[model samples]
Target chain A: MSVLVFSSLLFAASVAAGLLGAMTGLGGGVVIVPVLALLFKVDIRYAIGASLVSVIATSSGAAIAYVREGLSNIRVGMFLEVATTLGAVLGAYLAAKISGHWIAIIFGVVLLYSAISSFRSNVDHLVPIQPGTLASKLELTGRYTTADGTHAYSAERVPFGFGLMFGAGTLSGLLGIGSGAVKVLAMDQVMRLPFKVSTTTSNFMIGVTAAASAGIYLSRGYIDPTIALSVMLGVLCGSLLGTRVLVKARVSMLKQVFALVVVVLGIEMIYSGITGRI
Target chain B: MRRPSDHELELSVAGMLRFGVTAAAVVSIFGGLLYLRQPHASITRFQKFNAGGPGLRTISGIWHGMVHLDPRSMIQFGLVLLIATPVARVVFCVIGFARQKDRLYVLVSSIVLLVLLYSLGHGFQ
Candidate 1:
C-alpha cells in the first residue's frame, strides 16, 4: 500500500477508535495502540509515538469543554500535575531502556485490566470528609456542579493520591496511553474527590502529563510527523463528533460492547507479544 | 498586579486549550496533505520504527526545517505547540495565582512549570 492509502486507512481506524473511546469514556489512545501494533503492523515505538499525540489532541480538546462547563478543578489539577509530570519524565527515561517486546506485554496487561475495570460502574456516592493535613494545607477543596446543585468536596490521602498519579504518569509515558483509568483511580478512589471532579480533573491533567513525555519522545526521534499527523487529526475529529452523539445516545450499552472488544484485543496483543509476532 | 477572577481564569484556560488543539490540528492536517502529495518510493514502512532525520531531532534543526517549508518540520512544530499548550496553561495559572496573592498555589504552579522547563531543556541536549 502506498503512503497515501496507508494514511487513509489509519485515519479511518483512528476515527472509529476515537468515537468508541469518547462514547465509552475509555480514551482513544488505548484502542489506538492495539490497532496500530496488531492490525496495521506498525512498530510499537512509532505506534506509541503516534498514539501519544492523539492522546494529547483528544484530551486537550475534551478538556476545553469540561473546563468551560466548570467541571474541572484547576487547583487540584495543577497541584497533582507536579507529581504526574515528574513521573512522566522518569517513565520516558525508562522507555528508552526497555525493548519493544516488554512494552507490548505490558500494554496487553494494562488493556485487560482496563477492560475488567470498565465492567464495573463508577461509584457516585462520595462520602464527604475533611481533607487530610496535606490537602487542607494546599487548599485542594473545591466545588463542582451536578444536576442536583453545586456540590463541595475535599481531597483526602494526599500522599497516596500523589503516589498513584506518579504511577499513572509512568504508565502513560511507557505505554503511550492517556492512563485515564489510573488517573481516575487516584482522584476518585484514593483522593476521595467526587466522581465529576475526578473525571474532569483527570481530563485536565492528561494533556500535561502526555506533553511531558511527548517532548522527550520527540527528542529521541520516536515521533514521525507523517504518522502522528494522521492520528492527531483523526482522533480530534472523532472525539469532537463523539461528544455530539453522546447527548443523543445512551452509552451504557456501548460501554459494555466496547469493553468486550477491548478484552479481545488485549488477548490478541498478549498472544502476539508472547509469540514474537509483533 | 490586578488579579483575574476565577471565572476569567477559567475562560482563559479553556481558550488556550481550544486554540492549541485547533491550531495543531490545522497545521498537522496541512502537513499531512503536503506529505501525501509527495510520491513514495516504497510503501511507507509501518512495522519498522524510523528515526527521522535531524530535521526534527533538535531545536536548531526544526528551526532550519521551518525556514525551508519542510512538511515534517511543520508537523513537528505543531506537535511542539500541542505540548506547549499545557505548559502555557501552567504559566497562566502561576500568573493568576500570584496576582490573586495566593502564595501557596503560586509556589505549587511554579514547581510544575520548572519541571516542564527542565524536561524541555533536557530534550534539547
Candidate 2:
C-alpha cells in the first residue's frame, strides 16, 4: 500500500480502537498494539511505542474530565503514583532487555485477562472499609458527589494497594497498555475505595505511569514519530467522541462485542509469538 | 492564610491537564500531517525503530528540530510535552501538599518526581 493509504488505514483503525476502548473503559492501547503488530505487520516495539502514546493521550483526556467532576481522589492518586512510577521505570528497563517474542506472549496473556475481566460490571459500589492508620495519616479519605448525593469513603489496605500498584505499573510499562484494570483492582478491591473513586483514580494515575516509560521508549528509538503521531491523534479524537456517546449509548452489548474482539486478538498474538510470525 | 483544600488543588491540576493534552494534541496533529505530506521511508519503519535519531533523543535535539521545522522532531517534541504533563502534575502536587502543610505527602510526591526524572534522564541507556 502507498504511504498515504497505509497511514490513513492505521489512523482509522486506531480511531475505532479508541472509540471502543473509551466506551468499554479499557483505554485504546490494548487494541492498537495487536492491530499494529498482527494486522499491519509493524514490529512489536514500534507498535508498543505508538500504543503507549495513545494510552497517555486517552488517560489524560479522560482524567481531566474526571478531576473536574470531583470523582478522582487527588491525595490517594498522588501517594500511589510513587509506587507506580518506580515500577514503571523498572518495567521499562526490563522491556529493553527482554526478547520481542516473550513480550508478545506476555502481552497476549494480559490482553486475555483484561478481556475476561471486562465482562464484569464496574458500576457496583463496594462497602467502604475503615481507613488504616497510614491511610488516615495520609488523608486518603474523600467524598465524591454522585446523582444520589455526596458519599464519603475511606481507603484501607494502604500497603497492599501500594504493592499492587507497583505490579500494575510494571505491566503498563512492559505491555504499553494502560493497565487500568490492574489499577482498579488495587484501588477497588484491595484498597476498598468506592467504585467511582477507584475508576477515576485509576484514570488519573495511568498518564503518569505511561509517561514514566514514554521517555524511555523515546530514547530507545521505539517511538517512531510518524506512527505515534497518527496513533495518538486518532485515539485522542476517537476517545473524545466516544465520551459523547457513553452517556446515551447502551454499552453492555458493545462491551460483549469488544470483549470478543479482544479475545480473538489475544489468541492471535500468542499464536504468532509462539510461531515466530510477529 | 488558609491553605487550599485538595478539592481546589484537583481543579488546578485538572485545568493544567486539559490544557496540556489539548496543546500536545494540536502539535501532534500538525506534525503528523506534515510528516504525511513529506516523502518518507514507509508506513512502518521497523528498521529505524531501534535507531535513535539525534533530533528526537534529547531536549536539545527537539529544540534544534523545531527551529528547523523537522516534522518527526516536532512530533517528538509534542510527545515530550505530553509525557511531561503528568510529571508536571506530580510537581504541582508536591507544591500543593507542601502549601497545605501536608509534610508527609510533600515527601511522597517529591519521591515520585525524582523517580520520574531519573527514568527520563537515564533509563534508556
Candidate 3:
C-alpha cells in the first residue's frame, strides 16, 4: 500500500476506534493500537506513539464538555495529577528500554483486563463517606448534579487513590492507552468518589497523563508526524461525534459487543507478542 | 480583589483545553494535507522501526523546519501542541488556584506542571 492509502485506511480505522471507544467508554487507543500493529503492519513503537498522541487529543477535547458540565472535580483531578504525570514520565522512560515483544504482551494483557472490567462496569454504588483527613485538607469533596438533584461525595483514601493513579499513568504511558478503567477503579472503588465524579475526573486527568507520555514519546522519535496526525484527527472527530450520538443512542448493547471485540483483539495482541510477529 | 469562583475556574480550564486541542488539530490537518500532496506521499515504509530523522526530532528543529513550511515539521508542531494541551491546563489551573489564594492547590498544580515540563524537556536537545 502507498502512504496515501495507508493514511486513509488508518484514519478510517481510527475513526471507528474512536467512535466505538467513546460509545463504550473503552477509549480509542485500545482498538487503534491492535489494528495498527496487527493489520496495518506498523511497528509496535510507532503504533503506540500514534495511539498515545491521539489519546491526548480525544481526552482533552472530551474533558472540556465534562468540565463545563461540572461533573469533573478540578481539585481532585489536579491533586491526583501529581502522581499520574510522574508515573507517565516513568512509563515513557521504560517504554524506550523495553523491547517490542514485551510491549505488545503487556498491551495485550491490559486489553484483556479492560475487557473484563467493562463486562462488569457500572457496579459501583455511591455511598456517602467521610473523606480521609488528607482529602479533607485538600478539600477534595464536592457535589454533582443529576436530573433529580445534586448529590454530594468525597474522597475516602487519598493516598491509595494517589498510588493507583500512578499505576494508571504507568499503563497509559507504557501502552499508549488512556487507562480509564484503572483511573475509575482508583476513584470509584478505592477513593469512594461518586461514579459521575470518578469518570469525569478520570477523563479530566487522561489528557495530562497522556501528554506527559506523548512528550517523551515525541522526543524519543516514537511519534511519526504523518501517522499521529491521521490518528489524532480521526479520533478527535469520531469521539466528538460519538458524544453527540451517546445521549440518544442505546449503548449497553454496544458496550457488550465492543467488549467482545476487545477480547479478540487482546488475544491477538498476546498471540502476536508470543509469536514475535508484532 | 475578588477571586474567581470554582465554576469560573473550571470554565477557564475548559476554555484552555478546548483552544489547545482545536488549535493543534487545525494546524495538524493543514500540515497533513500538505504532506499528502507531496509526490512521495504514495510510499509506505512504516513496516520497520526507525526513530525518524533529526529534522523532526527536536523542538527547535521542528520550529526551524516549520518556518520554511516543511509539511512534516508542521505536523510535528501540531503534535507538540497537542502534548502541550494538558501542560497548558495545569498552568491555567495554577494561575486559577493562586488567584483564589489556594496555596495548596497551587502547589499541587505546579508539581503536575513540572512533571509535564520535564517530559517536554526530553524533546529539547
Candidate 4:
C-alpha cells in the first residue's frame, strides 16, 4: 500500500485503539504495540518507541479530567511514585540492552495477564479506610463520588503498595504500557482503595512513569518523533471522545468486549514472539 | 456566605488553561509531523535502523544523528519542552494553591510537580 494510505489506516486504527483503551482502562500502548509491530510490520523497537509516547499522552490527557473530578487520590499516587520511578529507571537501562523480541514476549505475557484479570473480576465497591502514615496523616486519603454514589477509600500496606509500584514501573519502562493493570492492582488489592479511586489515581500517575522511560528511549534512539507524534495525536483525540462516551455507555459490557480483544491480541503477540515473526 | 476571591478564581482558571494548552500543543505538533511524513519513510527507517550487519553501525549513526538533529533534537530540546511546560503549570498551580491556602491543591500540585521534575531528570540517561 502507498505510504499515504497506510498512514491513514494507522491513524484510524490508533484512534480506535485509544478510545477502546481509555474506556476499558487497558491503555492505548497495549493496543498500539501489537497493531504496529504485527499487523503493520513495523520494527518492534520503533513500535515500542511510539507506544511510550502514546502512554504519556494517554495519561496526561486523562489525568487533567480525572483530577478535576476529584476522583484521583493524589497522595496515594505520589507516595507510590517514589518506587515506580526508581523501577522505571532501572527498567529503561535493562531495555536498552535487551533484544526487541524478548521485550515483545514480555509485553505479550503482561497483556494476557491483564486480559484474564479483567475478565475474571468485578469492580469492588468497598468503602475506603482512612490513611495512616506521615504521608497519609497529611490527609492524603480522600473520597470520590462515582456514578453509583460517593465512595470513600483509603491507602493501606503502604510499603507493599510502593514495592508493587516498583515492579509495575519496571514493566512499564520495559514494554511501554504504563503498567496500569499492575498499578490498579497495587492500589485496589494491596492498598485496599476502592476501584474507582484506584483507577483514576493510577491514571494520574501514569504520565510521569511514562515520561521517565520515554526520556531514556529518546536518548537511545528508540523513539522516532514521526511515529510517536502520530500515536500521541490519535490517542489524544480518541481519548477525549471516549471519555465523553464513557459517561453514557454501558461500562460492564464494554469492559468485557475489550477484555476479549486484549486476550486475542495477547495470544497473537506471544505466538509471534515464539515463532520469531514479531 | 463568603464568595470566592477573584484572584483565586483567576488563578484556578489559569492553571486549567495551562494544562489544556500544553496537552493540545504536544499532540498537535507531534501528530501533524506524523501526518506530513510518508508511511514509506517510517517503514524504511524502521527496517534500516533494525537491520543487523556491518551496516548496523552506519544505521545507528544515522539514527542517532536523526534523533539529535538540530531544530528538533528529540531528547535535548523536545524533552526540555515536554518537561518544562507541565512543570511550569504545576508551579503556577502551587503558587495559586498557596495563595488560597488550599492544602489539598497544594499537596496534589506539589506532588505532580516533583514527579515531573524527577521523571525529566531520571529519564534521559
Per-candidate Cα lDDT values, in order, are 0.84, 0.84, 0.86, 0.67
Who is ahead in TM-score, 2 or 3?
A: 3
Candidate 2, residues A1-278, lDDT tens digits: the string is 67778778888999999999889887778889999988888888889999998888888777667877778888898899988988888888899898888898898898898898776655545445454577777888887777898777788878999999999999988888889989988998788888888888888899989988888887877788877887888898898889889999999899988999999999988998899887
Clashing pairs in 4: A128-A152, A128-A153
Error of 2 at B82 (Å): 1.1
Q: In order, how many clashes per candidate?
A: 0, 0, 1, 2
Model 4 CA deviation exceeding 4 Å by range: A120-135, A138-140, A145-152, B1-42, B48-125
* Tens digits of per-residue lDDT for model 1, B1-125: 57787668878877888888788777766766677677766644667877777788777787788778787788888887787888888888998898889999999999988888877775576
B41-123 per-residue lDDT for model 4 (tens digits) = 43455543452322111233334544644222332233334434434544665666576676776776676566556555543
Error of 4 at A278 (Å): 2.9
Candidate 2 residue runs with Cα over 4 Å from true position: A122-132, A147-149, B123-125
- What's the candidate order when arranged by decreasing DockQ? 3, 1, 2, 4
Once fitted onto the true fold, the runs of candidate 1 whose alpha carbons sit more than 4 angstroms away are: A125-132
| Interface quality of candidate 2 as DockQ | 0.65
Angstrom error at residue A74, model 1 = 1.0
Against the true structure, what is every candidate's RMSD?
1.7, 2.0, 1.5, 5.6
Q: What is the lDDT of residue A77 in candidate 3?
A: 90
Interface RMSD of 4: 6.1
| Candidate 2 lDDT for residue A89 | 84
Candidate that scores best on TM-score = 3
TM accuracy, model 4:
0.78
DockQ of each: 0.72, 0.65, 0.80, 0.20
